[model samples]
Target: MILLEWILFLFLFLGLVFLMGKYMSSVYLGEDTFFTVIGKPLENLIYKTSGINPAEEMNWKQYGLNLVIFNLLGCLVVFLLQVIQGYLPLNPIHAANVHWDLALNTAISFMTNTNWQSYSGESTLTWLVQMLGLTVQNFLSAATGMAAMVAMLRGFTRKETDKIGNFWVDLTRGTVYILIPLSILFSVFLISQGVLQTFHPYQHFYTMENQSQVLPTGPVASQVAIKQLGSNGGGFFGVNSAHPFENPNGLTNIFEMAAILFLPLALVLSFGYMVGNIKQGLAFLISMLVILLLGTGIVWWAEMLGNPLLIKYGIAHGVSMEGVESRFGVLISSFWGLLTTATSNGSVNSMHDSLMPITTLVYMFNMGVGEVVFGGVGVGIIGMLYYALLVMFLAGLMIGRTPEFLGKKLGPREMYLSVIALLVPPILMLIFAAIALMIPSTVGCMNNSSAHGLSELLYAFLSGAGNNGSAFAGLNTNTLYYNFSLGITMFISRFVTILPALAIGGSLAEKKSIPESSATFPTTGILFIAMLIAVVIIMGSLTFFPVFTMGPLLDHLFMIHGKVY
Candidate 1:
């Protein structure tokens, strides 16, 4: 316990420490004001879009209204494409038009960065529709997430303001200046790795096996770009990152994993930069890392161990090389599962359904953590900060000392809102998962395997609601029940946490950045990050542990004993 606590401080808490140092550097390095860093780019965007200057500040209502309208238009546009895909060209699979409910749900899903796919990619979306609808939303949703985070940071840094930068301005800069350029380079590089980017239809080529060879292709590079850039984990093909054309090589694997995590990781820098308090960002990043690493290490190690049952049945151990994608080895696959759930990339290379029972639970628990470690695009770091403020406030209250973070006082209003933001996703996950487990109609998903199989169904709900998008490959997830379940999860995952985050950002922006005092929690130092880690673990374990235990723990033990249930 003590050792685990230290690990949290060193890696997770180090973020806080780094933030202080980084904040100092931001202070001394450029002498640039916040407006310059944020405002100038926004000004350029305003010119390009409306041919007008938004130099004057706007009210929260105006800012929020624009964001809502913009996203709704996006939703309508994306939904139309899917419903009208039969009319589009380059559809080799002759994909049919999507139904109304599914189309609306999908549109909203992509618009929100949830990307909870209910259909197979190759057979569902036409090449044009894929690019127009799903692919486009990937970028927009990611930009939205980044914008939200920036808004929250503005709140923490500002002394008094009704505005938290222009939402349109921040969204524009994050997408054009940052996400686009990086995604373009990444797409070209992925092409070098043999990932397809052409409009060519599914190709059939001869192989030595003399068997019919079916190959799927499309504008993969475009979708792949924002999937990572926006922290939106939706994949182009049905099998997602598992498809050879989508992730063709190991280096590409490394790059995609990095893309999936880069901004989420870079967000540490952004937070510290915005607040003029580096430690705060670092502390959030470090605490997130501590939780992420522990989750990753356990999943990796468990998967590497192979199932004890398989070993007893004379199955090979060390690495179950046969069950995973040959293009990327088990090591890479484990890394992807770790990275994807840790962020929001839902694409799967290896079959997670095929993984050992214990391993599957680890993956879901990662989702349960609520993506705080350099979390999906804008979401993760911001989410972590809310909780960080919560802990700081509680700690302050306990000692009868005023809670000060960076320069702002931690008060009841901020604390309540942050807690609400933090609680929504996890609560939704547990309630939905529990419902599915207990309800026979929902539990029909467990048609094949034992309690282990049942575990996969629960995992999908957890992943979807968490907006992580990966799945337990064991189930035949093509039914109406799953489609609807996944849709609900995606919606809740994105919007539930988003509203609270926005509110918090709005509140924080009104306050001014305060100077550190005796009562100020040294978040950047090891201690606070450790506290954050404890909070995450306790919350995660208590929240999901019992359900996970019934779903996987006993099932794993049973599978090992050959009881099979």
Candidate 2:
């Protein structure tokens, strides 16, 4: 039955990919789309009202400057909203102002499209704040990524042109045409699936054991839809999708999981459409799937084997069900765990802290590889392209030819930017995590000791730096140190790559297309796909293997000897 569900999901998702990919390409290409009739008027109104000229084009520097300024302003607004939300309307529970550090952290988190939540939603925020602050950021942040991506794509497709697309136009179109429509439909479907969407206060009740329970509810369906579709995984409730109200049953579970990857994967195909090379897109799609499926298989097999220590004690069941929602069982939970981490969507149906050591390694590796296995909406493909550039550079070195991608020459400038963009996240993740471990006070932040504890700490930084906001749930990250440090990490990791990509785009856009020659490396074949996957694995493994050895690998060895950490 689980296998059937998996196959069914693949069928539905692939069908959506081609359809949606073509539509998205049309939207970005400024061609006629189904939404254009309605979207055009609304888009024009936004441009007029905001004083934005839709016809204006921007060089890479102008585009990057505008992009950074816009996101920073958004970060400021969200931070102010959180800190002053108590004075704002719709505070039925009268939730107090958030702490400054957390507010800053969350502001940066959402602005970067890394929706890392240090606080439980129900208790920490009111409905007004949730909608105006977090929900709004969900749409904008994802659109920010999409805008950056489209700009980068334009850089490749056009030659001898200093202009990439206008940031405002791309941002507006992405939100209006792509995110808003899909989110509305997904929200309606979620509401039908019994996910909550109400402004009512928490319901106070007594249980059969005379225990008090508060049924926390809010406008969850709306947030869940965008969170999944936009790859913004900040949950309305504390436990994320694990909360029954956020994801109620198998049907909702499967759909929400599909939603997470839907746009990211489609955008890959969309890249092909934009470049006029369908094979190029398919090569990327296949490479991503190969990595994604391999990771999923590993997690499934390891979790199904159950915990070795529990099996030895004769206290285990059919599968490792610890911290798993009984409704989804091992197969779905394992798949969701891997899938969520595989992309930038951090929503989880199971507790990642309880995953096996090897499973932890895989999850960490997914992020450590920069989450380019169908990564966060627009940015994931950008990350993959960076790897593509790196691979091409290496291929050029071997074949004794100048490397080119989509007719744009990969020169020293492009290679330097790509290397920085690719390597910065892992480097920052390691340095900060190492610093945290050295501080004696930081030990108190962990819920476990030794290797498992190391995994928890490593996972937090990995999630933040990778811009993939999922946690091991074993780390207490609300403290002053974590809030500020992780927030800084999130900000740096996000723009370091984005700015470099933009600069590379600008550089490429200015250069004339180098005609394909006998020395040109073919990027649309099986060999290219194989090399792409190999580069991703080799880069990821080389950077993260030692850390894995110290963390999850050691944890697994310890677990086999009947030692639990």
Candidate 3:
């Protein structure tokens, strides 16, 4: 039955991918699609107001500068909003101004499309900040990522041109045409499923036990729509989608999960449409799907196996659903865990900290692989492309041939940038995690000691360094040290990865395509797919194997000995 459900969901998702791919191609091409007609005026108005020339194309340096400057400005605005949110209007709950360090962290977090929250949303931010500051970045940051991706794709599609595309134009078109319309529809659907959408103050209610409760509410549905669709996964409420108000029912749960993956998968097809080859896109999709399905299956099985400690205590088939929300059950929770981390959507339906040890490893591995399992919308596929280049490079060496991808020769500049992009996240994750471990002050953040505690620290750095915002929820990362350190990690991870990707795109764009020959490697075949999978796994294993032994692996061994973290 579970297998059948997976099959059904896969079919539905593939159909959505094809439909959305066509729509997104139209969006990037500035064609008269359904959304374009509605959004064109607004898009133009934005360009005019911002003093951006839609016709202006930029070289890689110009494009990179614009993107960085725009994001820096966004970060500054978001930081100020949090610092002065108390003085701002629409403060029905009168949430106090955020502390400086946390505010700075939050600003960078949202701006980078990392959304790595260091504080609870309801207690820390007012509606105005949520909508104007955080929510606004949700759209822009996601748009920025998608825009970067479009620019990168232009490298493959356009020949003899150093210009990738207009960053501002791509950003505008992505938000106006691709993200907003879909978000609006999803928000309405969520409202119908009992997710809240309002401007009223927190409602006072009595629980069944007659205790006073302040139910936090706001424009949650609006924010949530883009959070999932844009792959910006910060929760409006503290508990995120796990909160009943955010994800109240099974239908809503499914919708949000589908939404998390929707664009990333579709963008793969968009790659095909832009390159004029559907099979090439599907090859990427297949690689991602294989990784995703494997991770999900392993997690689900581990959760269902029942913890050995519980089994010894006479709970038959002792499933470890301790941290899972009762409303969603074990399977959905595990599925969601895999989906959220796999897509770089860190929104959670269950607490990741309480998962079985093997499950935790899968979550870590997903992000460790750069979240290329249908990663974040534009960035996810682009990240995969880097790995594809790496695979090509390695394959080319083994066969004693010059490497090539998408008809562009893989020269040293391209290969070097791709290697740097591929390695930076893992290197940063390890270095930062080690520093955190070696420091006595950071030691107090752990909610558990020994292996599980180590896992929490590793996961935090991994999540931040990968631009994946999910947390183990077992670490008190609200300290000044973490706020700054992880914020830096997020900043470096987001940009360092992006800069190289854009650079490669620019490099590839300048080159002319050569015709395919018998010596040329085929990217769409099973051979390529196998190589792609091998490259991702080998890279992931090689970088993190030592760390894994001390964290999740030890935790699993401890659990089998009837010792639990």
* Best prediction by lDDT: 2
Worst 10 residues of 3 by lDDT: 29-38
Better of 1 and 3 by lDDT: 3
Question: For every model shown, what is its TM-score relative to the native structure?
Answer: 0.89, 0.98, 0.97
Distance from true location, Cα of 238 in model 1, Å: 1.2
Q: Give the alpha carbon lDDT tens digit for every residue of 127-174 in model 3.
A: 989999999999999999998888888888888999998999999899
lDDT (10s digit) by residue, model 1, range 456-505: 77777777777877777656555565666666767766766666667766
Once fitted onto the true fold, the runs of candidate 3 whose alpha carbons sit more than 4 angstroms away are 1-9, 312-314
Better of 2 and 3 by lDDT: 2
What is candidate 1's local distance difference test score? 0.72
Clashing pairs in 2: none
lDDT of 2 by residue, 1-565 (tens): 9689778878877998899999999999999987889999999999999999889999999999999999999999999999999999888778999999999999999999899999989899889878988999999999989888889988888888899989999999999999999999999999999999988878999999999998887889999999999988999987999999999998999899989989999999999999888899999999999998899888877887778767655765635778899999877788887888888998888889988888989999999989999999988999999999988998989988888899988889998899999988889889989999988788688988989999999999999998888898878999888998899999999998788878888888888887777767899888899999999999999999998999999998898777765
